[model samples]
Target: MHQWRTWHRPLVLFAAAMAVMTVVSGVGLLVDDRVLTGAAIWSKPFKFAVSFVVYALALAWMLTLVTRGRRTGWWAGTVVALSSFAEMAIITAQVVRGKRSHFNHATPFDESLFNAMAVTVVVLWAGTLLIAILLLRARIADRASAWAIRSGVSLALVGAGFGFLMTQPTKEQRAAGNLDTADVIGAHAVGVPDGGPSMPLTGWSTTGGDLRIPHFVGMHALQLLPLFLLAVTALAPRFVRLRDPRVRLRLVQVASGAYAAVTALVTWQALRGRPLIHPDGATLTAAALTLAATAAGTYGALRTGSGAHTSPSAEKELVS
Candidate 1:
């Protein structure tokens, strides 16, 4: 029982949950046969729920260490956990409100609940990623870790940024000229539609999907990019002579550029009032850019064979 308190326990649990989420999400994708929405028919909710649980448990254990004055990984993990919970809350609300359906629109319930929650999640997510970046910088002496940190941070910002702004309502005036006070009163009591569509569901373009879909795409960029970065870093060169000092820096730059391109494309889609499922020229362009960056990163990593070495630094010591 005493041994369970060690970092390995929670780390293993977190890793297991993540693995389950990947498998579950993949299966859900295969079954659903639809583009993955933030609040999708399957996968997204379960994944978020699992992530929330994992983060909660990990956070509790990490915070325990913090309270006991153990500082090393506590702060970073705590920040990430808080961010995860906030994101889970937002995703849960979207799921509950049926925000992923064909009549996809946020209700009053969703707006009131998730508007503030979404912003909070984005800020916390950024802060936590920043903390991770700084930690990597302090602890890593080699170029590989630096690239990982840069790639991770860049992707997180792009993803979280899209998520934060995606919920804002379109700039349209409220519906007017509707009457039937009795129906309104009765339907309000019975949860029936008194009008043509609910307020949140009303203004959404029927032809085009929601503009917020890009934000969803952007937010997960971090998820995929970091995995690649980690893999590349893990496969380091055997010979010291193969090491490239600039490899990490280049990888980070390519990742940043890729996400920046994504952000721009998402913003363009939002402005055009396009749904997420529609693959237009701009979306294709962004996809191409991301692929190009990925290719560049893969080539650079193979060519340089750079790897990172972690050690206690002035930053770590200060926290300790």
Candidate 2:
């Protein structure tokens, strides 16, 4: 296991910054009684702060896993850190002013701020792409971890791209008036307006499909895929099926594909304006197919890579 100090320094500091923001936002949520968009004014900042904390930490840890891309990865990580900070700063500042952070139509100043936030997204995407490219060229010895890192990075990029869907003018927005001068250009929910009945803390829409569902699911693949590998490796001794490196690699690949499938399905559901919990028959059928495919893949991995036919000594040497 890597030590805390060994992780990417800038990203670690960025994570720490987000942690402080989290605390401040939490305090704001408790003390400030103001509401925006039918939710607490501080709610958006608080959620963003917590999310960036996890994101920065995961990215920092990821940077530590490979040795080859240290220089380029460090620079990319710095960009990511800066972008994260700028985004949080904008969100927090808007909260302090008792206003909506995203898709604010209040004044020209707020629109400028939102434009700056959009710039950060572009910078963040570029930095993430650089890091992903570098990671593919990294020299990782463990096949399972290597596959996990590569697939995770690729999927995370896809997830980030899905977020751009929110930037488009909503159907209601277009229907209302001229899109060229629309006050609110972007929204989180697909079918309904921004601030409706939402889930308790996360503010995910219950009345309409939330784009954030796919966005969240996709972005976290960077952490989730690697963690899945960690889980499989940890359970190797207890589970004979997981002991084989080939099996572990196969499982990670299957998981990566399955995760991508899930992200796609949710994005599809959101595009059709279907709430996640209230899936129509098509959504259910797609989900069922995904589940079936994943199960079949898992079984195939176990059957082919169980190490049952190979001698113990040879198998150990081959893996090492």
Off by over 4 Å in 1: 1-44, 50-73, 86-112, 119-123, 126-133, 173-213, 233-252, 275-277, 282-320
Q: What is the lDDT of residue 181 in candidate 2?
A: 69
Q: After superposition, how far is residue 205 of candidate 1 from its true place, in Å?
A: 10
Worst 10 residues of 2 by lDDT: 305-314
Query: Residue 124 CA error for candidate 1 (Å)?
Result: 3.0
Model 2: which residue pairs collide?
A: none
Evaluate all candidate structures by whole-model CA lDDT and list the values in order.
0.47, 0.86
Over 86-141, each residue of candidate 2 has an lDDT whose tens digit, in order, gives 98888888887877767766588988998899899989988989888888887777
Which sections of candidate 2 miss by over 4 Å?
Answer: 307-320
Tell me the tens digit of each residue's lDDT in model 1 across 221-288: 54455455555455546644223335544555666666667666756765665544456886788778
Worst 10 residues of 1 by lDDT: 182-191
lDDT of 1: 0.47
